[model samples]
Target: MKRRVLIGLFGFNLLRQSSAHHQQHCLSFLPNPIKHCTSIRQSLPQGAMPNNVDARTMFSHIIKASKLRIISILMDNPCAEVIVVPVLSDNYAYILVDPDSKESLCVDPAEPRIVLEAAAERNVRLSAAFCTHKHHDHSGGNMELQRLLPGVEVYGSCYESVPGVTKGLSDGEIVKFGNLEIRCVKAACHTVGHMLYYVTNPGNPELQPILFTGDTVFIAGCGRFFEGSADMMVDIMRMLRGYRKDTLVYCGHEYTLRNLEFAKTVDPSDSVMSKLSWTERVLSMNMPTVPSTLEEVCTFVSSPTNSTLRFLISFQEFQYNPFMRAGDLKDAVNATSEVEAMAMLRSMKNRF
Candidate 1:
């Protein structure tokens, strides 16, 4: 009895989890979605083999099956797609797959059993697990996942310890995942080791840049400064504000509606109103509103001076997130600096 192995080489390269509680989970498996990417993937590729192929004969059929159906699959779809796995109530962890090479990685595998099962179903290997912070919901499954996925690289911040961080990263450091270039940013507000991973694919312009803000920044809101001060958060916002305008933000928690409500309580700008309406629509469909563009987050809707250009340019120079635009906020108008304004704003949010 022999096995036949078929390896499909799509263009050049080929291919690329964990488990947790039995909560209400949703699997969003996007396969090189043109609408989605126009964002990220992580790993190399391995094609699916024929059903009749036996274990021993599988290796023998590799070269023969190299030009099979995967070619058409890859040819039709050349960009990467993210598999959004909802874990632990409203928390989200992502799996980005590189189309050329099936190399993939998971972000915040809260439950190794659940995460690994999802990845196995997709035929993608877990090359790495990236932990944004040391929180139980985010990095609690690190050691377990490491045990499940032997030789897998687990990355975290160098400042504070993450649960099972094999690699301690610093700010401005670059990590390469196949074609994706990930830049580590140490945002030490939520937790001392709290970090953000920003990804950019220069090879594929079709995908937009991605920023994984783990409890540091959320859609229409920023996180409460637990370990750090308002000044520290202001600094983080100052640095992140400089990212590419089109960068898509994927945050840790699904707190958009609540954050939007808080935003209205503070500013109630046109952008906040529009964002409120949009968030409701997305939530109605039970979709995750994780990825908002950096441009949208940074630019708040302000009254336009030019009536004709109002439609084209509706955003003000201030940020949509009240904490991000503390200086421009009516609540914080009396504050001296952005740092002071941020402090005043967070104090208000803490009470609210």
Candidate 2:
């Protein structure tokens, strides 16, 4: 048997492969030939494809090098499986796997049945579950997952009462599922007990670190300040912006297009505008635009006026995301303080 995977800008078109001797009657790119991920493929009409799949679908298959990018090169029989299972409109529930041990964990699986079936598809059992926050959509499936997978380790924040958290984790706490070690980072503003999980594989250095940021952050925007003030957001943003430039980011929802669209209104620089166009192409293929590196989104430019505020703008190449430029926006809203700048930006974003 021979196997060949096509690597493109978006990721691999494993379903659209061919051999020199014969065109392997490969699976139709399901919904769209350009890029149709497994999850999105489930929604297509029984045996038919969609309309936008072919017509002007050039950019849809492109994984924008300027924005989010998937790790495909070093993924041959990798340590963990980052199975993205799309659920409930725009939410992404993940099933993480350690192939050697057959050990698996789920992140923010709000819908139990969908996640359980996704796990079944991979023939992996859920040994544990981590909820990024208490949001109903992120942790709603907790109790049921516990019911289905008895003795599963359910971890949540020490600050909130998560649905079925068998153990409560706090800032800096570390936990493991097989060879994957997850570091808990406390997040503020979106929710008091909001948490972000950072996973590291010491066994495989080539495999980049990954972060599960519930609603604390998005591709181009941070979460709305619901439970805290702008001051609190500044702290959270400061911490997240300092993450390793190579770290991969996965947020809760599919808000890349909307966030980038709003970001263009803030900077309108080639970076943001170009990313917006790229994201539009990604969604056109019904493909997900995620797993963006910290380097692509730590897009901030410091303000000369604010000497007290401290923010490390790591990726100067993409100094575009408005929320990342809190200090730089102080002058826009006549804000004398960094917190004031953040508040004004949030207000405008909510209305945008």
Candidate 3:
């Protein structure tokens, strides 16, 4: 009698598993079907399905029934929205809104009123403010924004003296706004406590990552070394270069035309520069020339060798940058190292 009882228990367990499998298959065929059948299987209560039905035929029928529903579900969610708000003179502030949640975060809001107005116009509730550094032009509106939207979190570098900072962030720290993830990168050069924000959509291949480079980097030029050394700037540049090639860069200012003009002085014969210069001139009259990819910037400043004006369309500006230029300048001032070159360039730019 004991042997018979043990066999009976074993058989019951097999029957339960078979029933669960059959239920999953039946659910697939049902009208108004659930999304992700795997999830449905895991959510099933014990003993939900009987073991007598044929699961294979049910699964096939479910697939045929749900084809249209699957397509409709896949088409529902769109990419998140990023709105650019121009602030003082050339400074820019960005408002990022999650498509699903409608929750938003502001980046480097120099003017609180403008940011607030923009958010209101878009019907998004501003939830946080992310400051890149302590510069008044970048973090000036932090306090005002805090006052306007009470309880809205303010995030800034732990090392920086950002105004109205509620949370101090460090290098490699990750912050989330809905489904979007933002990675904080330490980029101390233009200022000692500067940080860059890299935003990405995990598990979503359709959306590309974007970089919010405050004042550390510009379109064709880099920020002047305000409180750091040339070596520090080099380190930051190298770090930025390691990001994914397709990453979109949204910088702090509308200095692309000016930076590209300066780049022309460095490599006058570059054909690509000539084309881009003209393009920027036309675009500036109507729209902003931002959201440039890392790949485009890298190509624009890549080092070239033994080429004519056409072949030299893309040339690295590092050696041409008074700060990154090695050896002697026209005045016989020698910069023996990369750091020295950057120092010399910074001093010259100050005078220029």
Candidate maximizing TM-score = 1
lDDT of 1: 0.66
* Candidate 3 vs. true structure, TM-score: 0.66
| 1-352: candidate 2 lDDT, tens digit per residue | 2112222223332232234754321111112233433332232233222333322111112222222222111222223557676766688888776644668898987876667766664467888899999889999989998888788888999998788889999999999778788999988689999999998776665555778888988878888887988999889877867776667677888898888787777677776776676667556755676656666433211122333221223222226567767898787768898888889989988999
Q: Could you tell me every candidate's TM-score relative to the true structure?
A: 0.73, 0.72, 0.66
Encode model 1's per-residue lDDT on 1-352: one tens digit a residue: 2112223321221222223633445455423312222111111122132233222220100111232222111111113446666777788888777655678999998877677767776578889988999889999989999899999999999888788999999988999899888889889888877889988766766445777887898887788787999889988888877886657678888998998788898888887877777677557645566567666332211122322211222121234678778767744447878788888888878887
Tens digits of per-residue lDDT, candidate 3, 1-352, equal: 1101000000000001124334210011112323323222232233322233211111111112122211000111123556667777788888887654667899998877777766665567788999999999999999998888899899999997889999999999999879888999988888888999998767464455778889987666678778888789867766766777657677898776766665455445454365365446435433445555555332211112212211112223333333333233433345566567656655655554
Residue 8, candidate 2: how far off, in angstroms? 15
User: Candidate 1: worst 10 consecutive residues by lDDT?
Assistant: 56-65
Q: Name the TM-score of candidate 1.
A: 0.73
Q: In candidate 3, list every pair of residues with a backbone clash.
A: 301-316, 302-316, 323-341
Candidates 2 and 3, the one with greater lDDT: 2
Ranked by TM-score, the better of candidates 1 and 3 is 1
Q: What C-alpha lDDT values do all the predictions have? A: 0.66, 0.66, 0.59
